[model samples]
Each structure stands twice: as structure tokens, then as C-alpha cells.
Target: MLDDYGLIRVAEREAAYRYAVVAPQCPADLMWPDIRQSTLSILDAVIKKHAIDKGRVFLTGFSMGGNGVWDLAAKTNGIFAAAAPIAGWYNKDEAVHLTSIPIWAFHCEEDDVVPITETESMVQALTDHKGSPRFTRYQGFGHQHSVMYETYSNPALYTWFERNRIDS
Candidate 1:
């Protein structure tokens, strides 16, 4: 999935940043504890072993990982410089807590599985809380198509990621 983000190309083309992809060993439904813990563990290891710039760390995920992105970012508290969740659903009740984090969400209007309203309501809650999160909805696409179409070649998303920093 990290390949979809052009991360390898980005790393090869530039020397200023490093990227790592963590795949949790669990099914999607069991993602809450198992996958979340795995991701956090990988993140902890990365920070400890590498000369990483904490302020520039970013989080991104698609599908189940997308859902994990929202949950993890809120729980971690000022850890990620920015988060981008693709085709993921977030709990609307937790929206306000994400106000300080920069979020860029992507989804499809015709996604039958997750439904577009999942992301819509979360984005609305964020807006209601005076948070500005960038969102993109592919008008005629479905869940898988939207992610597959946008993931690899979106130059703007990468540029946006570069502009954010957590300062923690």
C-alpha cells in the first residue's frame, strides 16, 4: 500500500526523508487492538532506531489501515505531522479531538461498502469544531476504484504532506 503513495520513488528521488511501510498481521475486523498495536510498535521502533525528524513524521493508510489512521492519530496525541486516510471511516465522536492535527481524507461518492456518508459526517464534525481538513470525493467512483485511481500518482497530496509539521 505504501507503494501506492509513491513513497519508494519519493525516497529515491529525494534524500531529505525516509519512509517505512508497516503491515499488521491481523484481519480487518480485528484491527482495533491487533493492527493498531502492530503499527504503533513499528512506529516506536522506527523512532528509536533511526535519526528521524519527529516533527515531519506523517501517517497514511487505506481501507482498514485508513480507519486505523484516524484512530491512531487521535490516540497518539501530536505524534504525526499529518494524516491522510483513504477510503476509511472515522468515528464522528472523535472528530473534535483531531482539530489540532492536519488531516486530508479521500473517498468515493458511490462507495457502496463503506458509504460516502461515513467520511462526510466525520468531515462535518471536524468543520463544526472549527477544524479545517482537506477532503476529496471522486464523483463517479466506487470504493476500490477511488483508492486505486488516486493513490499512486497524486503529486499534490505529497506536496501537501511536505507542508505540514507537528512541532512535537
Candidate 2:
């Protein structure tokens, strides 16, 4: 992600840096192997075509996508540098699969659509598994998409992702 360079292509220390935000929204479900594989294929294609940095690859999502983030992180643990799932939900048992990777999860305490408990349970489970995951619990958002506005606007989040990049 490199934290919204405004453009996907930019120059950093005279070296050209390229990044892409590929959102696979089809089927709106991340559990489907076809969709997950297809998304991976798409990323692979983009990386090979554009020479994207493998170590900087990050995963994120909102709502259902947030839930997908947890699932995908578990299934593709070593593949992503880090993950930021907003208002996502997943089975607590799956926490074991995600213990090794860095995660930053967000959720509104007042969320009516997907209760904050969903995120809490996951975060708690991850911690129980000895995984130190970051959690940002906001109040008054109440499941509204405004949570995204507040989150994406923060520069620190992007920098956090950069710091967590995998070393190749």
C-alpha cells in the first residue's frame, strides 16, 4: 500500500516504486476458493506485470471484507506482510492459523450491523493464541461506513503497514 502515494507510480530515492490497491468485490465473500485464488492470481499478475514489491503486499477490508481479512490471513498466513480488517468477523478457532502475522483490526463499539463483539472475540482469541494483534475500537460509529473514512484518513495506519512489511 505504501500509504496512498496519490499515484500508484512514484519515485522514492530515485527508484521507481509502484503499488496497486486491488479490491476483489465479486461474490462479496472471501471464503470461496475460486474467488480467493482468483484474487491471488490477479495480484500475481499485477506483481509480474508491474514489478510490484512482494514484501510490501498488504491485505485489508471493511464489513464483510473485514471478515474476509481474517479468513484470508489464516489461509494465506505467510503471503501477506500485514492485515487490517475493519468490522470483520470470523470463527475464533481460526485464530490459531493467524498467530504469526501482524494484524490491525478496527471496529466500532456501537456497530449494530456487525457487533463489536465479533472483532473482540477474534482479537481475544488471537491474543489467547499468543498473537499480539492491534485493535482500534471506536465509539459512536454504529456500523456506519464512516468508520472507513476515519480510518483511511489516518497516515499512521499506512506507516504501520510499511513497518510490518516482510523482508524478502
Give TM per candidate.
0.83, 0.85
Runs in model 2 lying further than 4 Å from the true structure: 1-18, 28-34
Residues 1-168, candidate 1, lDDT per residue (tens digit)?
A: 444343454555655544654444347457655566677788788877886788888887777667887898878887889999878887899987889999998888888888878888888999999999999888776877446446535878778988999765
RMSD of each: 3.0, 4.9
- The TM-score obtained by model 1 is 0.83
Poorly placed runs, candidate 1 (over 4 Å):
1-18, 23-26
lDDT of each: 0.76, 0.79
Give me candidate 2's TM-score against the actual structure: 0.85
Clash totals, every prediction: 0, 0
